[model samples]
Target: MMSPGSRPLIPGSFLKIMFNQAFPGRPGVYWFLQGRKVIYVGKAKNLSRRLKSYPRQAGFDPKTKLLLAAADHLRWQGLDSEIEAILTEARLIKLYQPHFNLILKDDKTPVYLTITKAVYPRILITRQTGTFGPFSSTRTLRQILERLRHIFPYCDQPAGSRPCFYYHLGLCPGACIGVISRETYAKNITDIQLFFQNKKKRLVASLKKEMLNFAKAQKYEPAQAVQKQLEALSYFWQARVMSLELPRLSQDQIQLELNQLFGFRVNRIETYDISNLSGTNPTGAMVVATHGRPDKAQYRLFNIRSLATPNDPAMMAEMISRRLKHSEWAKPDLIIVDGGRTQIKAVKKLIPADIMVVGLAKKPDRLVGVNKPLDLNTAAARLLIQLRDEAHRFGRRQHLRLRSKTLFI
Candidate 1:
């Protein structure tokens, strides 16, 4: 009897071998192995598509190539649903320690924007307990806290403290001083919770109506304040959600594809875009997104140091290489460069083939891969373009911020 650890490697006989062995048709976790070593661990709703990817779509990555060369066996465990698959994958990866997966050190504790789980839950920025976030950055967590406070004034003040600074600054709705009624405060908190639960459009529309109402009552100051807040919320929503030509793929499909390609489901994707502005500052920026939402905490600004003059491609390559060398930053499943064929080719050489890479040509907003340009209308293409655009926006914002700071200094 062949031990599971010593399964025979029949060349060109994978399908025949797996045919006799049960491959779970249902959603669940799967593992590819080279004798005793686990090469990659993944989850899938359709085992056929997930298993097929190993041989059919296994793009060459240094680590994947080695795994493929040695892989003699495939195995899987069935799951109830796709969500379970994700949770299972995350758990197994933590336990088994696969080499291909981009596993970061779990040393740093997560900080959360906790609205205390109390009768009158107070909003606070903390690393303490109770529904803490695995948030990408402090800035991002703070922004979320601010938004929550604006929408639900009840959470803005300390539980027992007097009117806070926010009240004095006219940012809070004066909930701390009883200026806002309990019913109104509760309604606001309910709206905020609903928004966080993915009812953004509804919340935005409601806010718009309220803003108009204040204006109609000749309450110009309050109306302007509400309008400004609405604009900010709109900007945040647009930045995070992709409005595309194609019907958006469900979150599960996107997550599964990402996991298969990169060996893990990418939560925060950080892309680096370099720009020269006529070779003046010659800067590079690292932009971050978490679960398709902008995670500003991971955003980074860099002054181009390697080259004296402007070189967007080379500079971008160097920045990416440096970022990958660090263990703290989560490696993106995809690296998006903002350029045409030439730009893609240059960065491609620098990137290890294992990592999925693509370039976005700004002229037509096209995605350029190894040999062909993908049409952005396709679901896959749209997702890639969104990542590239995010990187570009982040880089541009950093460039402007640095330029303004320099002028002031």
Candidate 2:
């Protein structure tokens, strides 16, 4: 069984041995285990710092307090990046069905926007599968739904005997009033799906195409209406995309953007990642950036031994904690992890509140921070992306070396 953070401090020699033999403290997902069963699952930016905060008296949330008291041992995975951590934590929570996660077990469930399975289907808030989100901000998504409803009006209720109240408000186009044809309403539903899927570019392109078709058919007035709606969507979605928190443009640029975005001077940017063959041949890497360019001499690598099983969050957390323990290492102004929410949570605990933590999640790639997901259109985000890629490359190299050495035996 693992000790709680408030129990006692770690021994010096043990810390050294752990530093030598195990993975570096990096961002990751952790489990508060009661024997073999997981009672609760959580994530962090630094595994060491996060776990270290779990003292019996450490003022955690009520649910967390209960979870900590019941926890016997801990199991964790250090991850390659923050976004991966978020995805991994969610996946683990679903797979394990831990007792304490309110999101899973609660009756007053988180809301999801669902598209109905009907010819003239309804769009409604539901708890069903294949819906939009388990969003923290219901108001935000609801507002978006409301706004989108204006541009692409669809039925808010299933096929009804008479027109619903929303149709009069222009929130729905009165399919019940026979004012809209099936094919025309179907196109609006498709547009709604496209917007939710973050296919704004495709949706805009299609809208432009449709507008041109209208103009070509000498339907000038309809074409103008389509143009007006398309412009409105582009403007609104662009505002939502927002400017990204970036790095390595210039020393002055870094300071200015950091002050405006994350509220600090971001001179030194550090990125962490992990590589492994499933659970074996595990290696972790940290790459440093001074201003906008990489500082090659400051790069570090580790062959992970903390957990024999592959756990990306644990591996990353171990790496980051070890790094923070070293007083000699230069402190970073901003720390970038290669994954999303889980990765950010893992690292944020160890890092000072002033120092920003950012996660770059690939596959519909986004640069995410604590409560901030911004467009990755700027030069700084691109630079961070390169730095993360470099860390992964270096970590993979070390992993391959270790695997080959093992194979030779």
Candidate 3:
């Protein structure tokens, strides 16, 4: 239970030990126990940080406060990624029916992703029973389906002669018009099944085998298409992790917090990160967030030209310099660099004094340039970190793409 004094129920040393044993920085689900009964269940993208932040969260909901008061002990199970964490959290909540998972337990509120039992299965978001999930976040589940549909197209429309809107966009396999056969459509459904089951490794292996067989048969076009799919899948998880934020933070709440933190209304935020492997194919990414959410249309990437070594600060400076030259681009209220004081120092001198700049340092994640005290537990900090991570993932993918191209050359 939460102590009457300042001490938390889970000791810092215990959390450290658990993390060390489970693998540090792993994402997973955690449960709160009141004696023998499980009272609450939650998922975290980073277990170590999430566990620590709970005690610092000033804006916790009423349910959270109630759970903390009753929870005598805590336990967790770490997983590979955020996707696994969400799925596992849902399964555990279903099994335990935890008292505090009130919104998740409601059949009408949370989304259920179903593959309708039909000749050509229609992927759907419904409140009824589902094959894949009773996913807690409706918006996230919708976005997941949209992303996956582009990779493995399937029909979501009613069976008819007319092709659906997605069919015209090449996001549906044309099940309505018989452009895809039952056997081939079944394969697509199988791939989706594997994906929802968190069997990405198996799905990838199968695709590889199929590609190999296609190459052996001299079906070069099909093999190349499969290769592209493989590359997309390679970067999919990293990109997905950036987009999926559990409980889905509000843009208004984040901006309000930032307004207080900076003493200025923050409407546009730009975050930068440099990615490289052994100083080869170094790339830099700039991601923007307007009104407290990522604006992907404004995202930009740079291939490091000025530096030939792993000088992140220099690369970051170069990226900023180029970005500043674009007068048409909307000016940012805040700029977040993914490093320490050196990174901030590198780019700060180049930018206008009117624009606020800060760095998000790791090991112990904290803001570098800001004079005000930072509370990592706040939604404002989380938004900044998310944008930084998005930039990192974007830059890394661009780096990998360059490296892969060089290999073929």
Candidate 4:
């Protein structure tokens, strides 16, 4: 990855250094500050990873650049869980009303969880405030409701002559069909409300008390249901809300996996591709990925000054050689050339022994010019293929633009 110190001096350099020095890699909320004013607030499942991303992101994104330039410092607070981070971020955003947070987020209205003031109060998501929240992340809030609904089985629809869709799905307690009394359904709603209020302890106590009461009365069925709810709730808390979000590999996880695969700590990867049409208007492009995400600002396109032939390996070599001359540019920990063994051999000669080099071959999509065998199904292989494809896309576009210019010339 590009070291923050190696980059040109820019606004928020101090903040970047501070972030690198020691930000906890845990769930938390962070603030970007302009002097004493808090200009933006954001939450992350991993604080250090998210905060460090801003510096690289600012290189290409106008809004990120502007926000970082305007900010002088940063602050963060580590939280125990992702749920806590989400809740704390919403509360802080509300309290500070940060300028960049609102603007960068496009001033979208925050979502709220509201309980309707009716005979059978329905839990809902709305723009207006009512009972529970001005949650910052609508998707996350919805996911939370989905998970909790399976446990509490509250209603989102009005009481009707027939059972609602959720009632059939067991996500509602059959209040709409009058199978469950209003008072009993109300108790479920209360539990949900208490959950949104962050009264986990009180909610657990209430459920425990109800379970004991049912057991004492010999109502084994209701007692067993309550016991199941208690067990599920316990598992939910221990699960850390990760299930609520879609499952995807984090960049850190990807990097670690790649590290294990390569026997080296892989951080920065550069991929090169040559694009040409019968030796005419040949172009070579380099695509960079730092810390497992593309850093578009560092992408370079070469006009292929030294080669007019359609020799891909030679063209690839020329590009790598030219790129290496610029010592000030951040060196990649790994380099991927877009060809089989021959292309890899040409580029590997130019790179130092310490820096790793590999080729992505098209047939069956495997790694070449390296001793390690990599499975195409693995995350590490997928990332390499993704970068290789990006290189091809970038080089092909530049080559087409050059060809178009030649038409007029």
Candidate 5:
């Protein structure tokens, strides 16, 4: 029997009865039961440690408040290794559709730069998979395409074709007319791939030296052109470079950063903004940003549910209440209302005390909290502004688009 204050990992009076009757030692996976239904599933290396975690005061997160309220009883299955336990946890979560798990509904189709696997490899912008270059921006990729054409100098035409305009303009390596040997052409392709794979610094330096030599030898026009191409290549490289730091931060780091700056740790942040013309179609927008980046898919637009037309603060409060009722959406680390003190206070009335809330006033960009105006120069303040502004932009665009459509209809 569990001790006083040691509530079962899964909670409910009915589930508590069921859990007490069952054999508690065997552990492969655990399910959190609310009455007869399993709301969450987990695999435990040790059933005791995993089960104890749910009821422990220090182990709980503010976001897990709803889960704790709904929890009733804990059930488990015996498993071999930690790896198997992790795999089992994932499989069970997928099967159960737990409210706490982060669901990835959005497709992960990022754009890529493809070089066709051919003798005279032609470069093309495509979305097809199995390609090496997965560039984030099309504009950056276009710049890369230009630099590639200069460095590789492959033929735009078929093998037996006549020298094209590129060759006439001295851009091609004369591959179309077979002036560049097949061996050399193949070497160029290899070199191009190397550059794309971040092996370009040395090669670019060598190319620059060659261009300077050509300029000294009275080939002034070509040298200047090469110099220009080099500058473009340098910019292309800088834009696509990614940080080599740790991909995802730990929860401790997140909490520490938030606490030191904001006097509280931020688990999630929900920002609200109202968008409308003068007494026209007023709509409220709620954009959520977790940690730092905008989770656009989680963003929502509200077509003022209340009959109180043109009341922006009321519209904001309604949206907040409606969103708060949903079990899946976690309570925000901070609340950002996109208006002055009035809007901030309105939202505060709607939110529960477990969460932190603030507002960003547009003019001079100030943060309006419960008692005092937060200084905007701190790291947390900057992050709060970023989220608030993003919500404003998202809300404004949605409002404008809806208004435009209504006008058209």
Candidate 6:
């Protein structure tokens, strides 16, 4: 994607190098800084993959593009899980008040309704277990529960002799007075869970039925209450979505798409390309794509070691052997070798038979493998082509860097 009237903060080889150094492939919060002052804060499940796509942002909002264009340095802190990343991001944004982080400005932690497994079932707003929603909302979240309480009255306070706060407010079904039975209370909690899960179709249908039943029985007041509940649900849903514009594809969603197209579950893809002029200053570059996204952090370069002759096959095999020796580096789902039958034959022996390998022929532009050749037009084919292209670019860059260094020395 191209952005009009703006440019990337760090483009080209410098951008690739910065992504590797600043955003290691992990769940983390990254800060975009310009001369020591932080400008943006973003959280990602895979920092390397996300950062690599910044310069190529297709539909980035104006504010986001501006942040990237203004930033001079990148900083990040790794987290354990997506959940942890979310929580940390919220905290970081609040602390820094970063100009680009428009969300989490309110001092409010996302309100979640927790239904504890108890005799009377205590429903409390918290960020603890059995809770639902870190759902982004400034005002509508509390209004939803308040309006919902009229139709499905449950308690958010401890049962006591005196009526609890919500009970007195006419928002609870007197859980403090033991008016709600366990079986019935569980059903109410289930409905709440359904609402939180965004199963609004069933919830809305059920609510509509109750509203109609009340209307028919001449229970006008209760029916009016139910009508209000429906309105609240619809309003809350609309408001929550309107809080943010349509989001970009998340890391999980990207992986899901890749998994679907690749004919198997693919989390990692590795591509290799060899660059040299008749075997002098030969180098093989490895580029990694995690979850269908390029991850510059794992990209590597190899100098030809064992091969003295100008044999591409031998050079590729040597690079593969060295890469495979580092068991700590995460393995790949598929490997793209930038050559045809001869290259595949040389390297296929080193790779396990179970692993998928493909060779791309420049002359025919055909994907060669054990299976039928695929045109470089399909999504999967396009992905392989992208990997191959990136590997070639990286290898050439590294080769030039080596050449420049030798000349200077």
- In terms of lDDT, model 1 sits at 0.59
Name the 10 consecutive residues with the lowest summed lDDT in model 4.
Answer: 1-10
Q: What tens digits encode model 4's per-residue C-alpha lDDT throughout 205-278?
A: 99999999999999999888888787766655544554443235788877887898889888899999998887
Candidate closer to the true structure by lDDT (higher is better), 3 or 6: 3
Q: What digit string (tens of lDDT, one per residue) describes model 1 on residues 240-343? A: 21223223667666655545444556665666677556566667787766664557788877777788566777888778777777778776666767776666
In order, candidate lDDTs are: 0.59, 0.67, 0.75, 0.77, 0.60, 0.67
lDDT winner among the candidates?
Answer: 4
- The positional error of residue 142 in candidate 3, measured at the CA in angstroms, is 1.1
Worst lDDT window (10 residues) for model 1?
238-247
lDDT of 3 by residue, 1-409 (tens): 1111112255335434433443236777788787788888888887778867654452355545555667667777777667767767767766787777774354456567788778888888876456665677877787667657656788877467898866644568788888888988988898888888777789999999989999999999989877867765554454534453422667788779889999999999999989886678999999998987789999999988988787889989998999999999999999999988999999999999999999876423467887876554466766776787688779888988999999999
Give the per-residue Cα lDDT of candidate 3 at 154.
86
In model 5, the worst 10-residue window by lDDT is 238-247
TM-score of each: 0.36, 0.40, 0.53, 0.53, 0.37, 0.38
Q: Write the per-residue lDDT of candidate 2 for residues 1-409, one digit (tens) a residue.
A: 1222312113333233323333336667777666678777776656766665665333645655566556666667776444334435655666676777653345456456678868876787765343565432355556567556757888766457787767644467777777788888889889888776656569999999999999999999989878867865754453321122233356666445544555555678888998886688888899998765679999998777787796787888888888888889888887888787887787678777776778876533456766654434455555666787789888878988999999999
lDDT of 5 by residue, 286-363 (tens): 888676555788898877656445777777887788888887877677788887778877778778887877777642
**C-alpha displacement of 39 in model 3, angstroms?**
3.6
Tell me which of candidates 4 and 5 scores higher on lDDT. 4
| TM-score of predicted structure 3 | 0.53
Of 1 and 2, which scores higher on lDDT? Answer: 2
lDDT, candidate 1, at 164: 68
* TM-score, candidate number 2: 0.40
